[model samples]
Target: MRAAGLEPLEPYPGSGSPWCCRHEACGREVTPRLGNISSARQGGCRYCAGKAPIPPDEAQALMRAADLEPLEPYATSMTPWRCRCTTCGSEVSPTLMKVRTGGGCRFCASHGFDLTAPARVYVMQHHQHNAVKIGIGGTAGRNERVNHHRRSGWVLARDWHFATGVEAHAVEQAVLRHLHEAGHGPYLNRDVMPNGWTETFGADLVTPATLAAIGTALLSSLPVTLYCSGSSAGR
Candidate 1:
């Protein structure tokens, strides 16, 4: 994997296309597994996992979730559109597609789907709230590219500090500050065996777990630099 993972490519089948896997972002395209911000008919939904077009037999049960009446001739016989997603079915209701900010996945509860909760706030350094950079980079591929981005000043939402994998670790500075202010530092694993990574990759398709393990293992081997020299802000 090239450090930045960005390279000029000869237009080939899969490799030729830009691998876009972000679901909530604008202008992102879809990949086989990573998902992305695309039409509602793609393979999977970034927001709802792979729940659209649930089986037809189950559509009735799913429809009940939104108090939807029986499927109209145009409606899905089953929940979640009953087919990975029927093309532009729009059979599912706006309430069904409604994305509640927080964990209010109530709409899809009967169908066994869970939606993310609202975003939370974090206390960050001046640079964090006001920095000029907004990205992550840690792995040899996208990770490296994100690291390069940090060279420029940037600020990002606190939750982004972990999932972005830009630093190869999920240590959010705000979370770290919370721990440090209490005079406690987080564990940064640096002694993981090679197999640790292999096991991690098995379930790391989500990406955060993979980057987290590698980051902690790397952190464990590094020396700590204490920057708090001012008066101890009593917990």
Candidate 2:
């Protein structure tokens, strides 16, 4: 019995009586007839006595299907495991059931990132395209913004700027309309560009000079608007 897998829990001093042993898989103790090799080797633990535990391979497959990479030793489906979210690349220790139920990253879901703390306007340019990308950065912040673009194969061309998300949006719209009226019409490139910024890609469409002008105009507009709004509220 010792040579076999069963752990002997009692002194068997060669006594021709029933032997007490415990199964390693499940801690259930049982008495087998002395020298009964077959019965002694067939001790089943508590977990094995009921339903079989899920195999590691099957559990890993389930996690991969839900875009989560398992980072813990998988024992059962109910075990709390640490997994990385494929979407935002954030780690979260969610139970197997929670992941199986199509749960996503709470950080992204709740917009709990730095970008969302205060609305941000950002200017980014891609090397493949001539136009600078002016858009609202997601709540993830500037670093995440760069990561997102790089993942999409867009190389950052120039330095980026940040302002209030709302004011940045206004600047974007104003620049777009101004460029369009000057015969740079239909700047929105919905098809090719992944980020969907007002795409003005041409030799003379948008240059460093253009960006400087827009920035200056936006800087002047913000203070005036704030003053006007304050006057109205006071009145």
Candidate 3:
């Protein structure tokens, strides 16, 4: 224990029992099991391991620098700290350690498709495999998603533009669910279409016209704000 930077305060208990000791580096009392230390399962001191309680002022400063305003007192490093995003004004709770490690407010992160932005839902057909795929993508990418499939020999059968990706995604999911309930599932495997197999289905099970109708029906059921613009076929 001494070699591990911990000075035992009591007699050596069994390896399984908790042993109270003072961390020589931080001078903080800690109770750790000898078995854990012997087996290298955990460090002798949580403070030295960066798992101990952090100073509130320092934690707040780190959060502020990340454009997050803390709404609650600082807790453990791994626990979520309720904060309001200064950039998007959206309330979010992100762990302090995650923020320290370069993670920030998820609402402000542009890692995936922006659901609030305009997008398109497309139906594609792969004639050789007799398969069809229904998917959605952001309009900012200029039909790149459909064009990608087109390059893979999956011709674009139809596409509808919506005001938001969220609306288009909802319609796409509804169509997929309807097809699933009709005893149709993915027809292609990863080896066939690595990134898009999950959305592809046997064309015999659902024709392009049927898919377009399903998407239109789903769109009609949505609020007026979620209405889609004109659609195109055989692209």
Best TM-score among the predictions, by candidate number? 3
Question: How do the predictions measure up, each by TM-score?
Answer: 0.16, 0.37, 0.52
Ordered list by TM-score, greatest first: 3, 2, 1
Number of clashes found in candidate 3: 0
lDDT of 2 by residue, 1-235 (tens): 6554568887884535677788665465766555556555433342343334656887787777777788877866545577887878977655565555555454445542332234344445555555555444433335575467667655443332343444444555566556666776534364666445434445356754565466456556553122111101111
Quote the positional error of residue 149 for candidate 1 in Å.
Answer: 5.6
Backbone clash pairs for candidate 3 read none
77-115 in candidate 1: lDDT tens per residue? 211222211332323332233322121123334332112
Global lDDT for candidate 2? 0.54
Per-residue lDDT, model 2, residue 68, is 79
- Candidate 3 wrongly placed segments (more than 4 Å): 1-109, 224-235
* Predicted structure with the largest lDDT when compared to the true one: 3
Where does model 1 exceed 4 Å of error?
A: 1-136, 142-152, 155-170, 173-235
**Each candidate structure's count of clashing pairs:** 23, 3, 0
lDDT: worst 10-residue window of model 3: 226-235
lDDT string for model 3 (173-216, tens) is 77877888888878899788977687788888788888888887
Alpha-carbon lDDT, every model: 0.28, 0.54, 0.81
Q: In model 3, state the lDDT of residue 40.
A: 98
